[model samples]
Target: MAKDYQGEEILVVRRSLFDELGEFQGINADVDAYLPSLLNPENNFFMDRGAAEDDPSHKQLIPYCIFRVKDDQGTRYLHYTRGKSGGESRLHAQVSIGIGGHINPVDQREDHLGFDTYMAGVEREIDEELNIEGGHTNKIVALLNDDSNTVGQVHLGVVHMIDLENDDVAANEDAIANLAFTTLEELRGELYDRLETWTRCCVDVIEEL
Candidate 1:
């Protein structure tokens, strides 16, 4: 059975605006080229999630954060398996490198939606999912899109690469299981086939990011 998401509002921008800015298949590392206009108060707003879920006219803005750290060996990224309890049922059981969620009305500031408001939601979403004992800096590295599937059709991803001071992180939700940090080579090797579509997209061009 499908979960009832009535009354839930998520941040979204018109698909027309996305096309106007320039749309691509996978990851586009040109963030500065589109973020300003995309997050402008006049360009985006909150909408009923149930209605937005299937509507291709709107694209939900998701902050997909990738946590990474450089240790003795090499660079490693935080990864996990999506448990059934996750909100996106289609991605359950798949391995994911990113950690984030939907932006809601709570992220809005006094009826205004901008980069600050968008980032507030990003921080909140990450906090709700994980516990980080170390410091980190978040940088918006790219924008992700995938029109080949139902889930991807209605959602857009803003990829953030978070550079962690250390690998002291733990999952706070059951949705994130088997949490661990691994090298890029490992992710591209044995784990490549098990990765979710978005993660696979990010992995394919992560070096540039």
Candidate 2:
């Protein structure tokens, strides 16, 4: 049977309003104060992923979540992966440092306020993609974009950094693999070229991660 996308309706904004992603911002509580004016309610609509991805006139908001895993003393490394079996084929096993998907309407409700819908989507995607074994703290890190590629042109990533206090996070599905906690130096070296466009673009804002 074909995979049921469950009527996915991704929220998106104009590609131009961001302007070099405003040099990429890693926001905390202040994201709420800044987001309302950025999102045009009319431009934000739900459509099939296939069509939504090809339209460059708009940029979809995908919450890109990357968790930092640690154990006893301090930070170990950052978590990342690539889509594998059962996962979306378009990713084609390419490396993706962040874990998130489109903000669907089901991820929203009347109770959602400010960037809540996007944050809700972020939470939903992380749960579906990874298995966290212990305590963790999540914070919205940055708004990332790349008009440099076809896929990048159509999507804008809001980076979320999750600092996991345990060493137990793992990919729970065959659709995802190569789960690892790699250092920033390694990411800048060997794995740099392997990253998906949005990952490379968002790297600057998440330097502390």
Q: What's the lDDT for all of these models?
A: 0.94, 0.65
Residues 1-209 of candidate 1 have per-residue lDDT tens digits of: 66788689999999999999998999998899889998999999899998898899999999999999998969999999999999889999999999999998888776489988999999999999999998999999999999999999999999999999999999999999999999999999999999999999999989899
Q: Candidate 2 lDDT, tens digit per residue, 63-97? A: 77877765554454554556456445556667767
Give model 1's TM-score versus the native structure. 0.97
Best TM-score among the predictions, by candidate number? 1
Model 2: colliding residue pairs? 26-141, 84-175
Clash tally, candidates in order: 0, 2
Model 2: weakest 10-residue lDDT segment is 20-29
* CA displacement after TM-score superposition, residue 72 of candidate 2 (Å): 5.2
Task: List residue ranges in candidate 2 displaced over 4 A.
Answer: 1-7, 16-34, 39-43, 71-74, 84-88, 111-114
Q: What is the TM-score of each candidate against the true structure?
A: 0.97, 0.79
The lDDT leader among the candidates is 1
